[model samples]
Target chain A: MASFDRHRNRRDNRVDTLSDTAIEGKDPDFDAWLSQQLQFHEPYLDNDGFCEQVMEQLPAPSRRSERRAARFQYGAVVAASAIVAWQFPFDRVWMEALQQSISLYSLVGVGILSSLAAMTGGILAARR
Target chain B: MDLNDGDLIRRVVDGDQRAYAQLVRRYQSQLRFSLRQLCDGDRGLADDMAQEAFIKAYKALPAFRGDARFSTWLYRIAYNLVMSHKRKKAPDVDQEAVDRARSEESVEEAQQLGMARDLDSAMKELSEAQRQAVHLCMQRGFSHEEAASIMKLPLGTVKSHVNRARAKLQTLLQAWREEVVSGQL
Candidate 1:
């Protein structure tokens, strides 16, 4: 069968060298055979549930890690709140002291300068 | 702007999980269908390859620069995975078994005009690429040019492959026809 197969392959390669007349002679049978090739596709397979099954096999996303993340976030919020409470006494009281010592005109000028500075910084950041 | 696939790709790159799932749902069927040809009706392997392809695509999404169609890039990835799979488990693809399966289906679709049972055995004998070329033409109804694009081959190369495959199939069918004519089949 191996020898026969090799011989068959040789004959098939020789087909390219055939004259136009011989090629034309082979055309009708070839066309009929080509039509038969089209027949194999007639009964298309349905893969309806295929996607669902594939999606099912996907490694589930790490829920345990998500829970850990949530817990860490909650802890950070609590820690931040406690720090703020410890520092809260100075936040308002210091502002009152500054307001009392600084003149109204200087305070207004400082406030305007701060606003201009913030606007310039925002524009630079927006350009990027 | 009508959301481009590139936009969806950007969102997926930005860690939008829902956007990634939308991409999956959009392409799953076509990818599965292309892979079904490679797997030889082993739906499980096809599914595995498809999911693996998408996951790999997700991992590599950051590098996608949006020059080509997203589906085209995804197809290239899928074909690579399918090729690697074939290398690993080089399938024997029992022709007789495939023919039996086709014949069983043909019995039900006997009323159709071109539902000839004889082509099943002939088709089963084709090489994987040859079978793929034929399926892309007949089943997917892709023109020779469209198939070339989908298969990522030069148009002339695709034409030659399809022509040679068709010729081989024709020879087998001719023999089958002779057997039938002689009342020997």
Candidate 2:
């Protein structure tokens, strides 16, 4: 403990000297001190097998382009759906079905189910 | 002759996985070290972030214009990953462990161990941007402009962070200078 306190006192004196030097505009000592302290933490990462690990983790190069193509396909499908909805007499068919035994809620439910079915089919087709 | 980074990048873009591997090997240490510092000396987390950055870089390689040096671009990716990770889980720098390490007696031993502790604790005290700026510019020897680009901060902000970080570090590690003055270091 005595040794520890002594060491601490010595360190305190050095800091005072450097602080004075810094005030005098001879900052080289302070800069050197800062550099030494910072350099002490320079990390040397052990990188054996790092390259192999990264290589294994990289997605197949085509995967990115495939994702882009998938987006384009989805967009085309949406555009085609809008054109068909606009051009067809689907509103008349929907109203007629509503006038029949089918309630409006049932018709809406059916539409949702069919959309889900189409999405499932599209996913299955892509997988195949 | 070793291919320059641009050539390697061109080959990788042209579907040469070997060239990509070379790029990975060339920058792995640098990226890993930067991540380690950014992660506050958590080696495992640093390596994980580095790996994620490399994979992300590979996927985004096509979008990489040759505007920035490959290293600066890569560092940017790693820095982003570190920042995202920090958002998910705030990393706790173990100051107690650092304090324990500093309790050792010999001046040489204390200098070695205390400096590490002081630096780590000092770093933890810094704002995130300040820490990144200081590590990139002061420790890693990146030019202020390069560090600014990597951090995506305005040049003035990066400069301010570096200066403030240096001042904070000086105050934190004043004992080291004291040790030097005492002729004990």
Candidate 3:
């Protein structure tokens, strides 16, 4: 058995990875014998730049989690926007603001802003 | 860092190409070796299939749910590739009938071939299912259930495949024991 083990060691390292009787109903002797024969045939193929070749040919690793997170974030934003749109009467608020803008105080503020804009434009035009 | 397969796969999902490369380096030998067995010692075909399997695994990495070991999943990919290649190459070959027809004949041939070409060639006589079961269960240290997962076969089917394969490869078993006793191995 020690010689068998020695032979296995001299061969592939991964042989005998499991203990004897690792699998139920498996004959340990038969398992060892078969494993040894299998080991004899098994070769530890070198990488030989295969990894690099595969890497070079790989399309790219996808950032799935990032994509998923982005999707969730976008979904949440849309959902939030929809909720706000549904929960708040934005149309009514807009109409009310528009109605209020037509009042005297808004007209006075607009007139002041218009006068200020005209003064600024006149000063800039004069400088030019 | 010597990260586990899970961590490496996680990194791969997160767009770390180096992590996927590490995963490839870790399993390429064993996967290629297994594919070589399935390819009937066609190393080029095995390497090509192995490369394709790795690329497919990389592309499908994000969908991997960590339910099975990464290596097992990768083996499953490789096995599917081999089976698909076989199907495409021999579209009319009935695998079930071939398995049944070769069950007894494989043993007889293994005994004869074991004398000349040794174990690997004798292994070729076994049906693809049995050979895959033997390779995964014995050489690769996967449990029967793990092998079933990798082969995408039922557990009982995988177990029976291993049993039937060992029965067919009885010649190799005897030759091995004899060689070990004689220190010929």
DockQ score of each predicted structure, in the order shown = 0.06, 0.13, 0.17
lDDT (Cα, 0-100) at B8 in candidate 2: 89
Worst 10 residues of 1 chain A by lDDT: A1-10
lDDT of each: 0.62, 0.72, 0.72
Estimate, for each residue in B1-185, the C-alpha lDDT of model 3 and write its tens digit: 69999988876776668888899989988898888667655667779999999999998887899888888888889989988998797765445545654564456445543333446555666788888899899888889999998878899999988876775555334545677679985
Candidate 2 lDDT, tens digit per residue, A1-128? 33334444545454334443343334557666666667666655556999999999876767564566567567666676577568968778887897786887878898889867776666556433
Runs of candidate 3 with Cα error greater than 4 angstroms are A1-26, A61-128, B91-117, B178-185
Q: Between the candidate structures 1 and 2, which one is better when assessed by TM-score?
A: 2
- Model 3 chain B: lowest-lDDT 10 consecutive positions: B108-117
Query: In candidate 1, what are the lDDT values of residues B1-185, reduced to their tens digit?
Result: 24668778765554455566667777787678678657775556777788899888877777887765677678778878887777776766546655665565456446443224436545666677777777666545566776677677888777666676666654445554555458875
Candidate 1 colliding pairs: none
lDDT of 3 by residue, A32-94 (tens): 777766666565789999999999998844467657645655565556545755796756755
**Shift of residue A7 alpha carbon in model 3, Å:** 20
The CAPRI quality class of candidate 1 comes to incorrect
Q: What is the lDDT of residue A65 in candidate 1?
A: 39
lDDT of 1 by residue, A1-128 (tens): 23233434545554455444443335656554455456445544355664455445545445663465445555655565567558757556558758789666776677569656655554454333
What fnat does each of the candidate structures reach? 0.05, 0.31, 0.43
Q: Give the per-residue Cα lDDT of candidate 3 at A51.
A: 96
